[model samples]
Target: MTEYSRKQEALDYHAKPKPGKLAISVTKPFTTYGELSLAYTPGVAEPVKAIRDDPEDAYRYTSKGNLVAVISNGTAVLGLGDTGALASKPVMEGKAVLFKKFADVNVFDIEVDADDPADFIDTVERIAPTFGGINLEDIAAPHCFEIEAALIERLDIPVFHDDQHGTAIIVAAGLINALELQGKTLADARIVCMGAGAAGVASMKLLLEMGAQLDNVFMCDRRGVIHADRDDLSEHKAQFATKTDLRSVDDAIAQADVFIGLSGPDTVSKEQIATMPARPIVFALSNPTPEISPEDARSVRDDLIMATGRSDYPNQINNVLGFPYIFRGALDVRARRINMAMCVAAARAMGELARQPVPNSVLEAHEQREMAFGPDYIVPSPFDPRLIDYIPPAVARAAVDTGVARTEYPSHYPQPVVETDRD
Candidate 1:
């Protein structure tokens, strides 16, 4: 059976009842009236008074330290893009479960209906008191960019748009590992990015920060290659526009060492893949589809290192590789913000994880579970179980070092247990 069909079947059978995916149960008994008073009423006032006197101690007194809000307007629901808020609940809740399962962070999947960027920002800001951090999910590009910026500016807490930075970080990790395997360097390679949207634009920026030459990088959209001469370019695209004669996606692919396709399915031809430089790296990362099929790309260039966004692929460059651990670290540090250093560090961690000798479990996951790690295996298996232990500490340290953290977080071990609100 196809991997997707198998996965869907599992989901179908598993989701056969009400509250089938998640459950909430009391951890401590509240059977007595005195216990209820301590958990919910008069006795809870002790921690409240302490937190009021020293606000930073809230992380010590309540669940705020480990809770993240996976807030979305449902405007950009994966590849089904702009499906609206109500329709996006499943994906958001799924993200919450991943957050819980991966890092032990409590996630509240909040679906908001305010499509206006300003309204969404205002709503989130007003409700910001509730969450330790805000994870902006599946919002569309351009506007998503603006909303995240506004929220970060307005709130002291970390405000991250997972669609933009999470995908970028994971894709960057793949690129790092892929380039290493190809015996090439980011500084010397020419990159062609198809789809000048959220993930693509952020990926280009992050790559440039990692020493990719701006002039050698070409970013294109539906119209064509985004260049200084392009009449139609948003400020977002304008920043990365190049001064090049290559005005078409076809031209951009020609002579390029890397082709990153965040654009939708079947957009790139096999002929285009054949034209790329020797041993080219192609990340045709489209959801449920790709710009070019891996078989087709490999059919054209045997030396190519190919990846996609699907789990069926050997190297699935999914953001599922980044976000869970990222938030884990941020929350651990009581971070005020997630800055560039944290992202770069996370990417470096992921890239390093890819290069290690594939563990027996990973090899077994492939053989028993139909997944493996190799040339195409440029990342840990999504279910590898080490991401929580590895990636988060790296990011938390980066946040502390960059001075974006409010409470100093521990390294080498988790922080000591503290009394919760119910204590």
Candidate 2:
């Protein structure tokens, strides 16, 4: 068998056979030729005319209100880094599926292979009219920052880079809940972030916005802690550099109230985790492999509240838990932009949801589940149905109240259809 056919056979047997990864189903069906003419050509002219008369009604008449485009140039495909467009299809498709599963939003994952940033931006901009919002996924940092900023400024619809903002929002939410559970405040906590990459920088910024003391934050890259003296730090890392003379991860780790790892595997030693202050909140958020395994972390520090990007852990600080609901809120309000205020609002909503009494349904999901909210249960499980019903509405209200929303929808959304028939 040919290699392509062999691969296709495996995918067909193990993946596509389970209902195919995606399907383009009709929204409003046109079974008859008369209905087809009405829906496609002749009668569709009336709605087209109305939309032309009032452009805002385009959202009302078309799928634009509920459709989002997951656009990426494949410069950074997850931790697999800089894998180019064709290889990034699976990840983008996964994101599209997540949007559909979580918020009932229809999504098209567009993987573009543009050699130039301008071409990529222009491409997205040209297609902006068809989507309610644009989700920039897995694009590389520095460039992603520039792309997101320019697009948000140019497009009327909300534009978000899920890697930077989404990861930051969810991490901030987890930190908020962890600190609250530990009876600590962000302003007083000594936060040491490992990895001054896009997500770490954004997380630090969110924490700062939420009252974290800048002086107390120690950002570390591969070389160790980021200081003004460090010549190797990225421009994003320089912004978070502290005045402290501490030059290594060990020093920062010894005094830290929180250890946030966005770096690679085995970067954090057990000795450093052990050196953290009593009840230290450690979010080791490296992907398939964390900076320190939860078992090893818990083995070293009895008082540590540990979380990772992995699902098997007690607290999985994944962006999937944040962006779908966040965009749902933004789209609901027809938000023009996603500001720091909206991000803070999302973090607060996530934290508050965790503070509430755990529902029996959620407790049942956990194997060692208990009806309590404490160290082990700092953040709400992603499966918590409250994410859809609560968090997004809070964000929408925040967007509207902050004057960022271009238009506002009704407060009440119909109960979502949890089950879908695979055609």
TM-scores for candidates 1 onward, in order: 0.93, 0.91
Task: Score candidate 1 by TM-score against the native.
Answer: 0.93
Error (Å) of candidate 2 at residue 100 is: 1.1
Spell out the clash pairs found in candidate 1: 366-371
Deviating ranges (above 4 Å) for candidate 2: 1-14, 18-20, 231-233, 367-371, 413-423
List model 1 lDDT by residue over 319-350, tens digit each.
Answer: 77888899888887789899988888788777
* Candidates' C-alpha lDDT: 0.84, 0.83
The stretch of ten residues in a row with the least summed lDDT in candidate 1 is 414-423
lDDT of 2 by residue, 6-71 (tens): 999867754754643566888786789998998878899999999999998987888998889999
Q: Check candidate 2 and list the clashing pairs.
A: none
Q: Which candidate achieves the best lDDT against the true structure?
A: 1
lDDT of 1: 0.84
Candidate 2 C-alpha error for residue 305, in Å: 0.7
Candidate whose TM-score is highest: 1
Q: What is the C-alpha RMSD of each candidate to the true structure, in Å?
A: 5.7, 5.8
